[model samples]
Target chain A: MHLSFSSVIEILGIMAFTVSGAFSAMQKRLDVFGVLILGFVTAIGGGTLRDVLIGNTPVSWLRDVNTPLIILGTTIVTIAFKSSVKNLKVTLLVFDALGLGLFTIIGIQKGMAANFNPGICIALGTITGCFGGVLRDMLLNHIPVLFHKELYAVPCIAGGICYILLRAVVEPQIAEGASVVVISAFRILAVRYNWRLPRV
Target chain B: MHLSFSSVIEILGIMAFTVSGAFSAMQKRLDVFGVLILGFVTAIGGGTLRDVLIGNTPVSWLRDVNTPLIILGTTIVTIAFKSSVKNLKVTLLVFDALGLGLFTIIGIQKGMAANFNPGICIALGTITGCFGGVLRDMLLNHIPVLFHKELYAVPCIAGGICYILLRAVVEPQIAEGASVVVISAFRILAVRYNWRLPRV
Candidate 1:
């Protein structure tokens, strides 16, 4: 089967999230199995959640063999490069932003395909973009960064609304591409400016 | 619709879990909305997880109006009796155990209805029983009690297996009722005796 543009972005997002999870596990001194588990969960967690909420079962990962293989490959690469990977912080953040943007659009599209309300679609998009990190942070026993960190979910929701608005006039691919760019740029700028949500 | 025996237990479980979530939020000094959100998540989190994993969608709460109402009522009661609720530690634990036992069976049955493998069924049962509290603890920024506490998942899994075994020889209702008794007893005893799994 020919891989679509979104499919490539999805794989890239999975790899980025996997690296983030693996790094988190290493920082916490988790065992090898824990590292792999964390990596897998982080990469697919948000999508699994979105699928489940929408009643899609066995999840997307179980359906596609390639996703797991990619996660495994990413995990091995992360472990192999553990010493040098620390120096690639900027690259990692960029990949993470890419993953967030791509996953957000994917989630919104899935929700839209299911004919959910726009509000539910936006919520699904935010959950898709942000919950993987939230789950990763939670498993590591810390507060989820999405709850109070630099604007993450906000960008996802904004981008999702933009996608919905743009889809009416633009081709689906164009709307998706625009949303991805908007989300990634918003996240990158927010982090650069050290923006944070007000703590309750 | 007429409520089944398991349905009553399920509602009770939802209320108990909601109370636990509300208390955790109060301890964290979260505002009213936070408290309500935590309560709702804790009460529905596990089953929502199980359903999603097995392809059940919109989740049980969204299907049944009663579950959300129970959670809402429980949250209000928890807030109203905050001063007195703290003193009811034993009561809370008992209710939590009741919820755990009931939710486990409900989860198992749902998995069985979906025709999952026995191993997956048991896992679904345990997740259903335990994940709400895990989510609750995570939201409160604590390590999941299921991972390190006094034998939580063990009982759920063991009870789930028993449920499967008993179903072969007894009526389904009998098997479910037996499993609930076994799980709740095991949890109560473990807590009373301070039983814990060995750390890896």
Candidate 2:
């Protein structure tokens, strides 16, 4: 199958998110089935939610068999390498940030394609970037970290605004790449500095 | 606005689920905004999921503004009557059972309209019947009661199978109504007798 540049980025995001989810479930001491479910949900949950909310049906993951296969493969590999990979928290954070950035842009593009307003598009992008982790946390019976901590969704929202602005002056492809970089960089920096939102 | 007989049952289901959600959130001491969100999710979450899964765009709730308004109204009334309603656990369970039955039938009908096979339709019906409560429990940081205690989804699945069988011998309308009654009665009886599934 021929792979477009965007499809390649989406695949990378899926793999990264699956790894993040597998590690998280393992950390929680979930069984093999639980780990697999978490991996699949973390890889596709955000995109599924976005499609569902926007009336895009059969959802992206269900339409393409490759997505599930990729997640399954990732989960198995992660499990096999679990002991060696247990010490790489920083690496996990990096993968999570990359997935967050790529998914945010993908969500924005889908929203724009559907002619949603700019504000709504940004919200969709944020939801796409963050909801997978949200679902993972929820399933583990924890209040989602998104609701309380870190600079999680803010970068996606900011990057979405940046993408909209960049579209007026640059090529769409360039804007998309730039937005991904912006979000990923911001997320990494936020983690490095222990940035957090204050309580209401 | 004229209500068909089916629509009337649908409205009752919506109201029952909303009240169930509102009470659950209130018991947890969530703020008013949280209460409203829980109520809304409980009322429409299952149907929204079913619509999205079947490629039905602009989901039923979004197409009808009255649904959200009704949930909002129900939440407010529930909060206002909280003192008097606190002792009505049995009433709440009855409402929940009614909602489970009605939603199961509605989901089965939609799946049949889409020409899905019997098993997939039965699965869809169970999702519609139980996912709202599942979501509510998840958001509250609880392992979904559906996953553990009570004969929750069994009644929906059994009722769905019965609906399919009844279609062979009974009028379609009668089959629909009969399925709802079967599910509700089964659920109420299960709770009264403290029926439960064995641990895996």
Candidate 3:
């Protein structure tokens, strides 16, 4: 089965999130089963939420066998190279940004497909981009990254708006690609510059 | 509209969970909006999850406007009587147990309605009974009660098993009522006896 561009991005996002989750589990010294569970949840938690909210049942991961396989594979890789991977901060950051961007677009697209209102679509997009980390942090008994000073969900919301606006003037694929690029660049720049939302 | 017996139980569960969430938010010194958000999430989070898994769309809260109204009312009441309510530990415990039992049965019924496997049904029941508190604790940056030494999910799972078994021997309504009673009594007893799952 040939994969589409969106599917490719989705798989990449899954792998990135899985690796991130596995690393967190390792840092916490969770059991092997805990590591695997965290990886699986991080990779698909946001999408599962989006799908469920839109009334899509069983979720995409349950329908696509490859989703779990990829997450499992990523978890295995992370477990094997746990110590070495900890040193690859820049690479992991890049991958996380990529996943965030891709998931934001994917969530917005799904919401659009379901004919949700624009506000709902934007919210869905933000949830998709940021919620995996929320679930990961929650499971690890920490505050969610999004609820803090992070400029995380802001970029996702910006990208969602860009997608909505660009789709009218540009081709569908172009709009998607542009939105992903915008989100990724904004996220990476925000982190590099230490940009943060003001403390409430 | 005249309410059914089950609907009354569901509303009670919602109110109990909402008050629990509001109290947590208050303890954490969250703002009014934060308190309301937490209250709403705690009341409907588990049921929303179960509904989404079963392909039920828009979730129950969205369909029934009363759900949010009830949560809001509960939150207001909690905020107004916060100090006094703190002294009512036994009353709160009873309400929580009632909510847990009702939610467990509701989740199992939903899973059965969706034609899920028995294992899945039981899991759904457990999730429904316990996950609201999980979400509440997570949002409050504490470890989920279910993940720790608390004898929380055990009663839910036991109730689910009882529900399944009793359904085979009695009428569906009778089975449900019996399961709810068993769950509430077991939970209250466990708490009173300071029963706990051994720490890992």
Candidate 4:
């Protein structure tokens, strides 16, 4: 497939997640192979789940070798800057938010392309944006952080829905751009302002 | 599927894994929900992956309500005996070994039933036996114990090969029984004797 600007951003976002995932594993003092596994999952886990659920063959990472390089580069960068990142957790948060929104829109777009129902498309987009982290945590034996009343999944879903609604009113390209911005903006505002859903 | 003796043993093995997984979560000071997730992954994760790779819809736990119950029961028992088991790592090893062996054989059987190639079947069995632990550690942002150049994947392959070879010589029913026994026995003995592959 020909690469677009948005696709480049999306791939870069995957790289960022893979780096963080690798860093997370390193925080646990995992070995090199273990770090690679964490990186691999974080990079492709959500998208793989989305594709599998949609019955798409040859998972996304398998389709493109560049995906692994992105993951590898991210992992290397993460390890190199580990100590520096300790004081920059807030920066990390912002970056993660951007990736989250970007990935969510891309996920929804992928789902729509696959011709799934609106509900499932929204769900897949959310899964694609968020479930990679969930899978990473689940693999690490922690209850997924998302289920703990966080604003994570919400923004992804909101972005996906925004994309669908935006598409109904706007051109496809415009809708995609708007959806990414909406989700990313929501994440940024939520973090800065301490927005959260009501907990039972 | 009708419950056979093999099925009964498989459930028992899963119960053991669930107990230990929940116990590990408890040691980490996880809440009730977290413990359940750990137990669920420890017990059913291997088989669940096997089912998914084989294109089994809804996965095994979704197909079998009793599976969750067994995990729940095991979790309750594990939590009840948390203090005792916390100090008894060796006992946990025993159960983990047993579960590991049983899960491997079951995974290989399922793969064969799906008519996957033998090489893929063995790979699937090892993956089924071990990926859960890899996932567990990844979630915790830690290194997976399995990828530490240990006897982990090797033993699973060994056991799976045993099943395939034994089937060539024995009747179907006896072969199934023998396969499970051989795998479990090797697992137990390996742990007891500290048997492991040589370092490169």
Candidate 5:
């Protein structure tokens, strides 16, 4: 069966998220089963949360096993490609940044579609984008990257607003693509320059 | 100032949950800061998720600093009396069971106040009563004790049914105490007898 356009993008975003999570678990030297759990939780945790907050019962993931399957599949692929994962920190970071941009925009779009106000939409989007990674890090007994200052949550928040304003001023599709671009660029640039939150 | 009746019970439940979490963290040999995070999360995580699901603003703990203070107090007390924690495992287990009972009732009660269905109310109660510990264990890199062939989720489920049914048959205050007693006794008995879900 032919997949819908939106489902395709969502599948890609979810796949990217799962791969990043698996790689992080691998970095921590977790066992294979542990890697699977970490990837599954990290891929689903934020969206499960966003959906729960938005009153989506059974959660988006519990309703759709495909997402979890995709994560499991990606984890297998990562395991098969362990050598590459070992030498590709830059590439992994790029993929993580991409997932961050994509998921955050989609979350904001969902909130707006539900007709929540811009501020709430932005907050939902921020939660959707960063929470998975935060959870994964926390579960690994490490301080989450978001908490340790990475200029992370702010970009999601700002780009969510950009999506809202972009749609209001222009075409609808531009809002999605443009907002993703804004977040991705900001995140990559922040990493490139070692930007971080102020200590004070 | 005169506190609302429910608020007093809520604070007690939070304290119990916080103390239980801190004790568990100490059992796992986490640092002082780790104990603090565990306590805070256990105390507030369930309610935060519940409020967010209902689309409440700012989250419950964020709305009141007192919750943070309570969690902090629990953490400090647990650390200061770390030696006592080991010897007090049975006592901690009893309080943990109490926390589970109280949280189930409160979550079910909250859902009822929001006019949620019995099915959803039971689920909310289960989630509220259990997810915090699941989270604590997962973060400590252990499989959740609840999912481990155990009587953990059962008491919460039974208690929720009692809360819903008793409210239908009796006064609200009496139903509250009755549900708590039912849940607490159920958990204590299960622990004493080593009852659990059979392995899949």
Candidate 6:
């Protein structure tokens, strides 16, 4: 299959999400079906939510068969390499950060296409970047880390603002790439520095 | 305002959902904002999901300004009457059951209008009837009762099937009303009998 640059980024983002989801489910001792289901949910949950909110129906995942196949494949690969993978938590974090960046940009672009205001677009970006993990946590019967945890959504929000600002000074493609990098880097740095939001 | 029969049913269903949601949040000792948010979510979440799945854009709640107002009014009344309300558990269950039945019919009809298969229609009906509670439970950091608790979704499924069968032999209006009654009665009876699905 001839993969375009955009398609490659999409696949990588999906794979990252699937890996994080599979690892989380495995940590929770879910069964094989549970692991696969969680992986699929994490991979597509945010985008489906974004599409639904923006009134884009037959959600992107439903229309594209390859997305599920990729999730299945990623889950299997993660499982097969489980024993060989070291620093499992670190691996999950890295992939999650990458997916967060990619998905946030995708959501922002979709919001812009729908002619939403900048604030709404930023909200959509944060939701798209963060809600997959939120859904996964909710399914696991825990308060979403997004509600009370590290600097997660702040980076997405900041990146969204940066993207909007950058649009005036840079090419659209350059702004998109810069925003993704900014989000991913911010998240990784936050984790590295053990940064967290103050409790109320 | 002259209320049509369908509008009355819709209002009743939304009110039931809002009351149950408000009660659940209050039980958890949520603040005013949380209670109001949950009430609104419970009233609209199911229909929003149904519309999004069927590619219905600009979800029902977005188009209708009164729904939010109704939810807010219901939440206030529930909170104000909290002390006077006896048998809170029973009241919640009754309202939830009633909401389930009414929403199930609304969903099944929507799917039918979309020309979905009976199986898909039934799925949609069950989702509409059950997912509000699911979202509420998830937000409260608990496993959704729909997955492992009492006979919650079964009645919705059974009612959907009943509606489909009834449509073949009865008037459309009769089918809708009968299905709603069947679902509500089945759910109430199940609770009364403490009927539960056996663990695998």
Using DockQ as the measure, which candidate wins?
1
State each candidate's chain A TM-score. Answer: 0.95, 0.94, 0.95, 0.90, 0.90, 0.93
* Residue pairs with backbone overlap in model 3: none
Candidate 3, A1-200: lDDT as tens digits: 99987777777778888988887766766655557657887888888888776767767654555777788888888888877877887887787888899899888989899888988998999888888888888898877777986789999999999999999899999999999999999999999999999896
The number of the candidate with the highest TM-score is 1
TM-score of each: 0.63, 0.60, 0.62, 0.58, 0.57, 0.60
Clashing pairs in 5: none
lDDT, candidate 4, at B110: 73
Residue-by-residue lDDT tens digits, candidate 2, A1-200: 99987677777778888988888899899999999999999889988888888878768777789999999998998899887666776776777787799899988888789776776677679879888887988877776666556578779988999999999999999999899989999999999998775431
lDDT tens digits, residue span A123-177, model 6? 9998898888888777767677888886889999999999999988999999988
Candidate 3 C-alpha lDDT tens digits along B19-86:
88898888899999999999988988888877777677767788888888899888888889888877
Model 3: residue B27 alpha-carbon error in angstroms: 0.7
Q: Candidate 5: what lDDT?
A: 0.77
Q: Please give me the total number of clashing residue pairs in predicted model 4.
A: 12
Tens-digit per-residue lDDT, A44-106, candidate 5 = 888877777666677877777788889999889888887875587676667667778888987
Model 4 C-alpha lDDT per residue in residues A20-65, reported as the tens digit of each score: 7877677666655556667777777888788788776445554355
Badly placed stretches (over 4 Å) of model 6 are A1-47, A53-55, A60-134, A142-200, B88-92
Candidate 1 is graded, for docking, as acceptable
Sort all candidates by TM-score, best to worst.
1, 3, 2, 6, 4, 5
Summarize candidate 2's per-residue lDDT along B156-179 as a digit string, tens digits. 999999999999999999998899
Candidate 1 wrongly placed segments (more than 4 Å): A1-3, B1-23, B26-40, B46-55, B60-134, B141-200
Worst 10 residues of 2 chain A by lDDT: A142-151
What's the CA error at residue A171 for candidate 6, in Å?
A: 25
What does candidate 6's lDDT look like per residue over B1-200, in tens digits? 99977677778778888887788899899999999999888888888877877788778888888999999998998888877653576766676677788899989888888666676677679878877877887787766665556577789989999999999999999998899889999999999998876431
DockQ per candidate, 2 decimals: 0.23, 0.18, 0.19, 0.11, 0.08, 0.19
Residue A20 error, candidate 1, Å: 0.5
